[model samples]
Structure formats: structure tokens, C-alpha cells
Target: MYCDESGFTGNDLLDQGSTYFAYASVAINHEEATEYVNNIIQKYKLQGGELKGRNLLKSTKGKKVIAEILSTFKDRIKVGVYHKKFNLACKFYEYIFEPPLSEKSSLFYQIKFHRFISNILYLDFVCRSEEAEKIFSDFQNLMRKKPNYLFSSSETPDMSPLDDIKTFCIHHRDTINQELNSLQGTDIGKWILELSTSALFSILCDWGKEFNQLKVFCDVSKPLKENKELFDVWIGIKDKIYFDFFQGVEEPITFNLSQEVQFVESDKFPGIQIADVAAAACAYAFKEGVNQNTESWIEHIPGMVIGKSVIPDESYTDPNTLDATRNLILLRYLAEKSINKQPLLDGIEEFLSAVTHDLNLNPSNRIATIAENSRSDAPYFNF
Candidate 1:
């Protein structure tokens, strides 16, 4: 597969106006991609170079070419989309509340906890833009250090990022917010916040499992190039079981990946150019909303897209609806492994019960459930 990304704002995700990030992997060989590019160039009487996706989306002819390419090779393409704001919230919750960074796991993580936390943060960031901006700014600063950052400090910890989060939670003491108070004066270490590397690996894992082996070609990406060794370790992870310390739940994931990727220039590889177009177009469709120009592209995306945005539109979700709540639980479960089904269901029920109580307290407030409220009827493909 050939890969490329679009709308990458690096770690500066909040202010860049690049609300969505997309990484696309196209399953077309070099010869086919080359032929298609040559044909398009000859047919359109256009300049021959790297057929940039961003440029292609500009004009009627370019858009037509993109539409044709998408329609022609819809099944062979796989795109991963990330809602930047939601993604940032998820990162914050994961680092502060889950796994190696945080000492213990929270029961909330199992039952749409990430979403719950993200919704709260998302709202705070949206409603209180200045304060929200500072939170992200502090977070970006905190993540630039070497040596493991400590979360449980005996001495006074740097409170820039941690305090920002705590202040937000303390100001509004809800269930999720109060839970965030655990990291009041702690720190989360440096983690590469870019989406491309992880997204590419996920696509590789899925494709690798299907093909048993893959000869991958990625357009020269700094993250992919720098984290080559990390990718190797991730694919061949021996300890597949990641235990949730809070619930004593062991989530085991087995990967069938066994290959190294080759990072090449898009100018030399037509396949990578095709991936570029697909990724850029996909990101644009989501970020700009599906209009007449983007509707055709959306039609080709449903099954091919492997998206991470649990909540596409924050407000469209109806938290009071049991079905919506159930779907979120289901999506979370399906995305990760659950060895014990009954307890998981019980957990979901407990969360729902708590939601009911919370709703009764403030009937005017709408809870954010997972909803597909994009301009087009494009389905979200999780996992």
C-alpha cells in the first residue's frame, strides 16, 4: 500500500484551523498508479509533475479528476480521519487518566470515558476559547521535555498544564471534571502527538493481517521516518495483553503484521501521489462539509474510511437516548477486546444510570453521544 497525509498541524492542533487530519493508504501498485496519472495528464493536457491533491481540489477539472480516481479505486483505498479537537481531548484524557503515564486506570475509560472527558474539554474549549487556548499552550510546552515526566510528585510539580486542567475541572465540578483533579500537580511525559505515524501503523496492521505481509510505500513523512524502529517494536509486540489496572480487565490484541515500510518521495512514486490526493480530498470533505463538489467523494468513502472521530459533531448526539449510549459502548467494546462480557455490560448500565442521574440534575443540558452529523451520509468506520 502507498500512503500520504493531509491537514497535519503537528502538535499545534488547536489553533491551526486544520480541524481534521487524514492519512490515506492506497492499495495500488506503482505501474497502475503511474498509468492513471499519465492518462489524466494526457487527457486533461495538464502539466506533469506530482499530481498534488490540494491543487486538484481547486478547479473543476482537478475536482473531476479526483472524483474519477475515487470512484475508480474506491475499494482499494483506506483513509483514517481524526477530528483534531476531539483527538487532543482524547490525548489529554489518555495521558492524564490511563496507562503508563498515569499510575492507575479509571473505570470510566471502559464506558465511553474518553468521549465523556473529551466532550467536557471540547465544550470548555469551545465555550471558553481563551482559557481553552491556554490549556493547549501549556500542554504543548509540557510535552517538549526529555526524561520521564512524573505524575505523582512529592515536591511541587510544574503546574502550568496540570493546573490549567485542574482549574477547569475545579471551576465546574462534574463527575468527569472532578475525576480529572487526580492530575492536579502532576506531569505527562513527551509523546509524539502527530497523527500520521499511528494512523499509518493502524492501516498497516489491518492490511498486514489481511495480506500476511505487505510491501509498503509511504510519502516521505518525518514521523514515519523517525519512528521506524518504534513501528517495528509495535508490530511485533510480545506482550499483547494490556491490563486495565482499575477493573482487572486484560485486553489482549494480536497483530499479524510482519514487514518494514519504505519511505519514498512522492515525485518518484505515482502510488504515493494517488495516496496524497485521496488523503487530502478525504480531509477536505470532512473539514469543509460535503457540498455538491464533495458529495461524490463522500459516496466513495463509507467502507474505505477508518476514522477515529467517535463524535463527528459534538451537538448532534442525544445523550438521553439509550440507543445512542448503547452504540457508544458497543463501539468502544468492538474497538478493543473485552474478555468478560457481563461485567462490561454491567459497567455500561452503571454508566447509563449515572447519566440519568446527571440528566435529572440539569435537564436543560444536552449530553454528547456518538452521532453522525456530517453534511454527507458518510458512515464512521472505527477499528
Candidate 2:
């Protein structure tokens, strides 16, 4: 597979102009990729040293070329797109919640909490909740290892950012709190915070599952190169990276990559160049939506997506959507799976029901007041 990325801001996900990050892997070998690019260039009669996505997006004809390219290669390409802020909120959920909850009830953690909690937190973030901002800020501060930094809850009781979700942390404060306090000092904490790193790992795993012996060629990236050894160890020996968190309750998963990813110049590789176009098209279309001319190219993208779309369709917390109702039901299921923990189970059911019923895209005056009080001194929208 050939890989390339667009809208990569490394660790600076929030401040970047690109609101979405995209990484694409094309399942075409070098010989076929070369022939395809050469044919397209001749057919379009374009001037080019390298068929860069940015340059192709500059003209009407170039866009048509992109459209044709996507139409022809749609089945072979897989693109992962993430809204930067939403992605950050997901990281926050994983870091703060996963450590404790995954340990307690692996089945529930795998089945529900990861998706449900992250979606809930994402809703809180886009709705402009003050607590979401504070939590996100604390996570950023923690990852960056700012001196004398403390979680918001440490200074003020009942003031930590999760709002309703904080109930679980409170119950398991000994374990959860220890993780929060010490995670910044660890390497995994720092690594998990990088969106590119996460996307790369996910997409590679996706490819690995599909093919038995895989060879991945990527555009030159320092971050991927730095993490190469770590990736190999994790992909080669899963137990080395993560405990058998699921155990026999869940089926074993495997990642197969025969050799280390070879980083090469995009100019020399046709496959990486095509992947560049796919990634760029996805990043732009998802971030800004589509115009009249580019809509054809955009239409073909969803089929190529491996999981969720670039932006989620439902406001996860709004009761008007079935998504909220589904989350409520999931909480009840969590209560079922939870072992002999009445208080925690009750808290889960109560918190999710209340939050789902109360939250909306637009907050009420009272909700706004809570938001105003909960936010950090700096504005949440700025990032």
C-alpha cells in the first residue's frame, strides 16, 4: 500500500488552518501506479513534474482530472478524516476514562464506552461547554508537561471538566486520578496525543487485517520514521503493547506488516502522489464542504471511508436524535455488564439519561451560564 497525508499539523492540531486531518493509503503497486499517472497526464495534456493535489485543485480542468482519478480508483483507496477539535476530545476521553474503565469491565469498555463516551464528549465540545474546554486544556497542558500543572478538579472540588462523566472518575479516583497525575511523565501519554500517530496506526491496522503480507510505502514523514520501531514491536507482538484487555470475551485481532514502512519521495512514487490527491481532496471537502464544481469528486468519497464520516451526522447528546436514545440504552447495558457495583451502575444510568435529555446544539440561558463559568480563562473557540 502507498500512503500520504494532507493537513498534518503534527502535535499542533488546534492552531492549524486545516480543520481536518486526512491520511490515505492506496492499494496499488508501483508499476500500475506509474502507468496510471502517466496515462492521466497524457490524457489531460497537463504540464507537470509531479502531479500534486494542491496544483490540480487550482483549475477547472485539474479538478475534473481529480474527479476522474477518484472515480477510477475509489475502491482501492481508504481515507481517514478527523475534525481536529473532535479528534482532540476523543483523545481526552481515551486518556482520562479508558485507563480505569477498561481495567474494570473490559467487555463494556470495548463494546460501548469508547464510542459512547467519545461521542458524548465531542457533543459537549462542539456545543461550547466550558467543562469540555477546561478538560481539553488540562489534557493539552498535561501532554506538554507544563510545570506545576494540576487538573482543574485538584484545585476545586466538583469543578473538573467532565461534568456528568466525572462520576465514574470520582468512583475510581484512586486509579483514574493516579493515571491523570502520572500519565504526563510517561511516553505513551505523549504518543497517544498525536493525531497523525493515531491515524497512521489505525489505517495500518486496517490494511494489515485485509492483507496477509503487507508492504507499506509512505511519503517522507519524520514522525512516522521516529515511531517506526515502536510500530514494528506493536504490530509484531500485540501483547507487548497492550495487555489482553479483552481476553477470551473478545476475539483475537491481528496486524500483519511484513516489513517496516519505507518512506520515499512523493515525486518519485506515483502511488504516493495519487494518495496525496485523495488525502487532500478528503481534507478540504470534509473541512469546508463541497462547491458546485468539486461536488462530483466529493460524492465518491464516502464509499472509500472505512468507518465514520469526516464530520458526524448527529448531535450525539440531543434527545431529538436516535443517537441520544441509543446512548441511554447503552448505559443500561453497561449497568448490566458492570459487576456488583450498584452505585457506579446507578450513576451511569442517571448521568447519561440526564445529559442526553438536557443537552442540545444550542444551550439554554442557564446552560450558557454554566458554560461561561466552566470555561478556562481563555476562549474555547479560539483553538
Candidate 3:
């Protein structure tokens, strides 16, 4: 299958003009994807270079082409969406990293995104500066790697790598700004990431059930380096993603990276183009706030969507605000068990306790045991 996203702003996720971020992916029925792409190119007289979604969604003819494409491939597409606000995310991080960084606010309360995000929060929000040199250190000396078979039973308490934070928050209660309540925070890129990977793994999970390997393709967002390839920009989901079903009693469903997944220019493959169309269409649907004709293109792209910000349910979501805990979990994007396909809401603790999942010479997945001294005013994050 192929996957791609619309409305990517890198760290510019909180820009208000970009209200929503979406990821869309299509299954790899190669012959059918090719046939559809050819029909669209011939029908629209599209020049051979590429058929990008943003361009295709701009014209009346393009709209017709999109509508027809939707009509043709509705079942093969999947989408996930998130609405974000950067300001709110900043505030939440501040509140977490604010003064009184002890007790519950210790290393136990947060998932550092496999050590990628803790410094961002600790330095940026909490106003602590010790190392401009070891800025790349893995935040925790985690005990294990990604948890695929850890949860053998639902009856097992959700003792994930992320459990420490949940437990700390539940017990300490006042470590963060509890009143700054919102379901999702403004860290839009992370939210986009959360949405994108979830979209991919949902397919991986279902395919895992069938014991079938699925290859993933995504549109190229970065300039291709001559010899090196960017790996797993999305954490938790590495070159491979796996999850155990049936309470971990069954063999885990596993998927790998690079060889199993390919990142390509949109022009070379028909599937990526369609995924582009589908991703943009999803962005439009969320903005329109209605699923009628203007938004009908989404009807053609079928897949589960998480973090739907359109619902008026303030009980959990408010497009205009930020909720402390949710945003924290979101920024890390590594607290859930992709291996067991377990709910990621608790995956951070597992991530905190995990180690050595990487199989290569370059240890990009840096992990460790870390417990910052919350109250020692000396600014201690001694690894």
C-alpha cells in the first residue's frame, strides 16, 4: 500500500491557517492502481511528470477526475486527521515543565519520546540549560525494546512503558496544570505524526491478522540525499511495526522498514498520486465540516480516522484549546504498543522501560535509564 499526507508544515504545525493535518494511504493492488492512474491521466490529459493532489484539487476538471477516482477506489483508501494549535501546545509544555518539577513530575511522569522530546520540553519550557553538546542523548536507560508481546492479557493492568507517567499523574495530581484542559494540544506535527502512523498500522494490524506482509510507500517530503535514506521519522513505528492480537497469546504481527516500505517521488508511482489526492481530499472534508458533494471526494477514500477534531464533543476535544496530558502523550508519540496493537495512550511507559530494538550499526534509537532530580535546584538530568 502507499501512504502520504497533506498540509505538512514541519515545525510550523501550529499555524492557524492550516487548521487540520491528514494522512491518506491506499492498498497495493498494483494492477488496479495502475489502471486507475492511467485512466485519470488519459481522461484529464495530465502531463506525465506527476499528478499531485493540491494541483488536482484546484480545477473543475480536476474535481471531476477526483470524484471519479473516489467512486473507483473507495475501499482501498484510509485517512486519519488532527486539528492543532501551537500556542496551546506551548502553554501545556510550560505547565508541565514549570516550577515545582519534582515528585510526580519526575522522570516517571512523562514519556520522553524515546528520549527525543524530553529535552525539547525540559529546555524550552522548563528553562533548564545544561548541555548544548549532549543534546542528542537518549532520555532514559529503558529496560526493553518496543513492546510487542508484553501484554499477554487484557486482565493485565496496562503496565506499559508509559504506565509510570499515568500512575504518577494519577497519584501526584498537581504536577501539571490540570485546569488547562483540552483533549488535544497544539503540537500539530506530532498530531500529524500520530495520525499518519496510526493510519498505516491499522492496515498493518488487519493484515497481521491474516499473516500477510504489506509494503508501504509514501510521498517524498525531503530532498533525497545521494546515498542515505531518512528512516522512521515516525517513532514507535520503525522500519517495521508489529502488534500482538488475542491478548498477546497469538504470535505477534510484525512488519519491517526500508525493504518493506518505500519512500518515493509522487510522479514515479500511481499509488502515491492517488494517496496524495486522497490525503488532500481528507483535509478538505474536515475544513468543510460536512460530508456532502464539496466533501464527497472523501467518500472514495476509506480507512479509519483518529483524532477527528470536528465533533462538538468538548468533553474530550476542543479545536481551540489544549489539554495537558493528551498533548504530552501526543508530542512523544511512543507510549503505545504497536506490536500488540495496544492502545497507544499508555505506550510511553513501555517506551520508557524499553531498549535495544534497533538492528543496525548506527544506534539512532538511543535509549537509557533516566530519572531527573525534580527538586534539586542544581538543574540535574545526569544520564
Highest TM-score scorer: 2
Model 2 accuracy (lDDT, Cα): 0.65
Order candidates by lDDT, high to low. Answer: 2, 1, 3
Off by over 4 Å in 3: 47-49, 86-211, 223-260, 291-295, 298-313, 317-383
My TM-score estimates for the predictions, one after another, are: 0.68, 0.73, 0.48
lDDT per residue, candidate 1, 1-383, as tens digits?
89999998876667566778889988887898999988887887767666899898888888888988899889888888888877777776665444321322443555455555455456556655554555555555544432332222223322222233443333222333344444444321223466776787667655644464467788887767766765666444433333443346443233333466788998899999888988889888887777988876677877778633233454323455543344343334422322222322346556567765765565443333333211112122111
By lDDT, the best candidate is 2
Total backbone collisions, model 2: 0
Q: Which tens-of-lDDT digit does each residue in 1-383 have in candidate 2?
A: 89898888766656557788888889998999999998898999979657788788889988998899899999889888888776776666666666655545554454345555666566666677766666666666655556523243343234322444544444444665576667554455555556665666667666655565667889998777766776675444433122243324322244666678789998799999999999988887887677876797999998877553334433444434434344544544443343234544345546556554655433343234334333243222111
- What residue runs in model 1 are displaced by over 4 Å at the alpha carbon? 99-106, 145-191, 234-258, 307-383
Cα displacement (angstroms), candidate 3, residue 241, comes to: 10
**Candidate 2, position 355, lDDT:** 55
Instruction: Please provide, for model 3 over 51-136, each residue's C-alpha lDDT reduced to its tens digit, 9 standing for 90 to 100.
Output: 67778777777777778776666766666665533222333333333322333333433332212223233332223323311121
What's the true lDDT of residue 73 in model 2? 93
